[model samples]
Target: MQTHLARAAASVDTRAAIPEPFADDALVTQPQLKRLTGDVSDMTIWRWRRAGIIPEPTSIRGRNYWRAGDVRELLARLAGGAQ
Candidate 1:
């Protein structure tokens, strides 16, 4: 019974089994940002960008990326860390 349970657990597709491509402090693309931000919608990020709520992303060879640390800092500040 234990062997069968272990086999079933091994076969289960666990999302956490996949390794993240970047470190927490690394620059990340939009898709990575979505994952980091717990799947927040792209439209929300776009609106935040337009409203200057978040720091502007940097472009590299036509691709946009943001520093994970910067995003976290912004979120922390907005959560009233300054107060």
Candidate 2:
């Protein structure tokens, strides 16, 4: 059987990936995260959070959301070789 990571990568369509956007401090949902991250799976995102590579979302009411600004900042840091 293919590994979980392999399966996850296979399910993604890199052709439809979008360019990263300039984000604000407004809260965004998982779908937005997937879009921003080039259509990665939810599981991948969860793993990123678990590994501390991504900021955890803030739970509000019955939903989870992340700050767009926080995501932008992290990505910038990573792009700058701060990893």
Candidate 3:
């Protein structure tokens, strides 16, 4: 059986992997997002979700997964104040 971590790694496409300072699993959870955004609240993330400002998550066995590339692109757009 594939280890849980290995499975998660395999789920991401090679092109979506983050290199350098950000770890392979850096953006794997909401808490990670909080760290990235300097304590951004869950409500803010949910609001973005409702507004379609970021891509919706993919659920595996009821767990939501967001690719790092998607998060990075969304963050970039948000930084540029682009809708």
Top TM-score hit? 2
lDDT winner between 2 and 3, please give it.
2
lDDT of 3 at 23: 49
> For residues 1-83, what per-residue lDDT tens digits would candidate 2 score against the true structure?
12433443444443333234635767878887676555667887888788777788998896778887776665455444444
Backbone clashes counted, model 1: 0
* Deviating ranges (above 4 Å) for candidate 3: 1-27
| Candidate 3 pairs with clashing backbones | none
What's each prediction's clash count?
0, 0, 0
Give the clashing residue pairs of candidate 1, or none: none
TM-score of each: 0.54, 0.62, 0.58
Query: Candidates' lDDT values, in order?
Result: 0.56, 0.62, 0.54
User: In candidate 3, what are the lDDT values of residues 1-83, reduced to their tens digit?
Assistant: 12322333334333333455664344456666544544456776666677776567776777666777676665555444456
| Model 3 weakest lDDT span, ten residues long | 1-10
For model 2, the superposed segments whose C-alpha errors exceed 4 Å read 1-24, 78-82
At residue 41, candidate 2 shows an lDDT of 76
Could you give candidate 1's per-residue lDDT for residues 22-74 as a string of tens digits?
46568768776555444556776676677666678998998879986675555
